[model samples]
Target chain A: MSRPSTRPGLPRRGVLRLAAAAVALPAAAVLAGCVPADHAVTDPGPGPGGAAEGVEGRVTDARGRPVAGAFVEARGTGPRPNPVPEIAVFTDGDGRYRWFLPAGSYAITVTAEALGRRTLAVTVPHGRAVRLDFVLG
Target chain B: MKPFHAIAMASVLALWAAGAAASDRAVEAGVRGPVPGPSAGEAATAAGMPYAGSDAVSETELAASGVTLGTAPVGPLPAEMGGSEVILNWDSRMVLKTTLYPNRAVGLITRNGAHHCTGWLISRNTVATAGHCVHSGRGGTWYDRRTMRFYPGRDGASSPYGSCGVSRMHSVTGWTVNGNRDYDYGAMRLDCLVGNTVGWFGMYSHTAPLNEPAIITGYPGDKPQTQWISSDKVRQALTRQVRYRMDTVGGNSGSPVWSDRGEALATSGAWGYAIHTYGNAGAQYNGGTRIVSAVLNNYINWINRP
Candidate 1:
């Protein structure tokens, strides 16, 4: 199936452009805060109207194959509030999923039948893309 | 010059007066009574079945024992101007007495043996929950009914009312197709009439359901199979959603955001105002899809579906 916009209200082009830019930049320069992109910011502070940051990730099994239809549940681990919906997103044919959420800490859990579940805690920075991948055995 | 200013102020006063009048009309027109579905006694009598199976409480015994409903009275609606803004209060507790009224109505939902979400009974064989609980939105398809189960009055490791398998699940096109959060409510048809013994919550709607006591009872994933509860006032009531400061986690998605009216037979025992959905929003208030006419009507139809 064609991958739909993982984050509601954000165009697919914006996510693709961010992904592409992340690839082109040298890791050392990007880490040193030299790369300038609309969604690449170091500060995790709140933006205007509590701007949403992007969270895109992939899920795979222990065998390193993409695990399609794995349920990815995201919950805000809040000291400050994060507004992610309770609706769990699933991986596409490529085992990739993306979500835009208000910048805050989140506990993302990936689960599928027989493969078990794995949870990762990540703090989403405002106006940036955070990658969170999972491997279920 | 004084006359000109007076004319301007008068024009402003006239507009304000008109607005206030409309606001009053809206509040008055918004008041709706609860739909108290069959009580445990009534349901048992109608079905010709024994009441209170598996540690459940019988309505007759509960009434005779003088147990309180523990619901708030029907309070007056606040002024329409900024009425939705309520004081944020976050406090929740574990409910040890899950077999009582209103508590027994709530249920734990399991999708393929894993604790997924919460739901509540609206009829003998019908339940109301979040749309996402029944069908994953947008990129996801509807969940298979065979893999889903509902357990009423389920304490940790002790299911007082047993469990029922889903016969069918129902959701709106807005959620199933468009993935709209405004229409994030759904219902399920249970294979058995578990609600007849465990009871159900009546739904209440008001045009301006602001400042009303909001209670959420559900099994949070953090707590495993146990049920927890939180209570506060409706902070904000939009056209299709209501916001509150009640503490909730992921599995509390389909929990009923209801206000108890304390009268089971005389009026509704409790009235569900919204179906809890998403987590906290920009303003830090968690919310759900408010039960407007369209939503309530859809639930009523689903409750009666074969």
Candidate 2:
């Protein structure tokens, strides 16, 4: 989700100060990263009124064993990388990655550890989280 | 919290040129504003233009390519982002590519056949880089003192937008005089409007702990035919500097630390918040001068000059 713009914009000549401790706003979701053991997850939750949405899922081996540190890339079918993403991330020890994308269709690529790689397409709806799990062949 | 104080725009340039330290550090402007392009707000809208979202390729396709991918997420990136962190990927590799919009607008700047640094286009003809890129005030004070060359989107042997050569450059007094890393930002003016074709990034000024996902993109001298981009989270957001864990190399000195802030915040599709200047792999922290520094506003004014 996007950060709120300064209301009325910066006065023509006067500069507006960005709010300190702005992390208090809905955090941008961690697309993919490692979560240390015993550490609490401060996931940036959905934006106000669920105006936006996110996707979360796990990656596993064909044998169904969870995989971690696998590379996951989410590319929007747009003409350009754009405001959304042509972004790549890695799964965590729990074999999971989560993202709050501006509503759009996405082609996600997962590069499994030692098993090779695969790509999947999904259209995320507004105001919700979509779950899609994959088994690396 | 660093208190915000607006300085007189005109006096910023005068103070810098006349050797007055505006703050602990001072910046010099290159090309006066309002340049012939979108106002900062309009550019922010361009920066925030939305994407529809890319599709699936086969495992065989992945096997056939040789592109290196990143392994970490947007937290604190490894210090000294260059070296092993930047590996080449094949799918996104430059072949007979065409669009130069954002990538090509970023360029490889070289001097003395040895100094390789990165820079980004802010207007049709101006390039913004680290002040140390233009002049390393190392020891006492010493500029590159050599002719500089720029290759926009130069991949291996290919130059997508050809090369741009110009000498009109500017740097902040802190860097030019004392080599202070906090004030390490610079800008250059080209003779032609390369940005009119390539498009440029918009600028924004904000305070600490933005904690947003950020990407540091640049032409790394270590990689072959590749522009390395490491996506990570912004860390240690001080009033004067922004830090990230994205991987970068020596040549990436002036790379842009860009974030996809919204239209209300960033103005362009994704706005660059800082001018990447240093890397500290061991400490696991790399940083650059924040774009919001008053010195940069002076460059915005300089570039906008009629």
Candidate 3:
């Protein structure tokens, strides 16, 4: 909310008739707020080019035990200057998460509520899947 | 360059000032919500006598003065910081968006025929939104109140609590006149008692909640028929805004930025602190107009005014 470098946008010039999109997934189809069984615990597999680059890792608590349900996010430099978009996923029961992002630099922030605060910088090599783990207090 | 430039800014001030006078008199004449008719639609006409609402206003005034509906004060969606939205998952529950805090009343606000922004009900009939969402204070035109509609607790086509039209909209004169980003907050009077039905999030100001757990929920136009929620903490608390790195897209403008510290409030255990407006990509943070004393006082009077 720094002085918006830009002014408020105009209402659409004319009504741009847009087809309303309504795609209803199974209502509340989550268990204990963790991802579904398939996406959770199970590896979501990798994307196209083996060289496309990805990041996969496990989250653990102080004692080195898996920290399930931790909110993990990888924030990367985005196209625009104002809004920085990022890829966020929850660690599965095994406290593991894997997401393929265009090879680049990123800052990952983990919010586990009780674990205090932990932030780490990660990289998606030009076509390499990097493995990094977090040990939270 | 931004669409709202010097000339546009001046027009916003002049036109807004004129409308303010009419709005004041209209309110005194028992004109609760804006005149609701085809004439009061998005385009305000200069030549016309006003009608009354039920016997409510006619009982008070024989001939209501002509009230012109300004062209939509709120204009198009501003440039987005090029971001994507992420749905939340909690215990495999898909993080059902609306029920988590039904009374919080987070939903999409529609205006100017097709424009959309996010807002939340603060009173029985008053809603708080980004200043730009109610009127394009910076360089855009003011939206006709008749063209505004609020869908509280809206989940896709299903409006669990129902929808209502905007009656009167108000933004700080600083915003309307100076187009100051610091004053990027506004409120709208709804034509119906929707807040009483769906409940509203309580608003609090004058608190410095740096790093406080903050939650944002809104209907992102990117995901039509769906609402998204971001659970994060305040990264920076400024004089008039709070910054956070919450996943958001084009349609999240005017969203309520609230904290889960509602145990003290008799309503939903959430307190609204700001209205999400702008964000930065590399900076990785979104900024919202913090509900400071200035914003709070203006809104309290606007909502409580006759």
Maximum-lDDT candidate:
1
Q: What's the lDDT for residue B33 in model 1?
A: 45
Q: List the residue pairs that clash in candidate 1.
A: B84-B235
Docking outcome class, model 2: incorrect
Residue A117 accuracy (lDDT) in model 1? 93
Off by over 4 Å in 3: A1-137, B1-100, B112-115, B262-268
RMSD of each: 20.0, 22.9, 21.9
Which is the better candidate, 1 or 2, if ranked by DockQ?
1
Of 1 and 3, the candidate ranking higher by DockQ: 1
Please give the lDDT score for candidate 3. 0.54
Worst 10 residues of 3 chain A by lDDT: A36-45
Q: Is the docking of candidate 1 incorrect, acceptable, medium or high quality?
A: incorrect
> Mind giving the per-residue lDDT tens digits that candidate 1 earns over B202-277?
6645568788878888876656578888888888888888998866766788998876544332233556778999
Cα-lDDT of candidate 2: 0.53
> How high a TM-score does candidate 3 get?
0.49
Across all candidates, what is each one's fraction of true contacts kept? 0.15, 0.01, 0.07
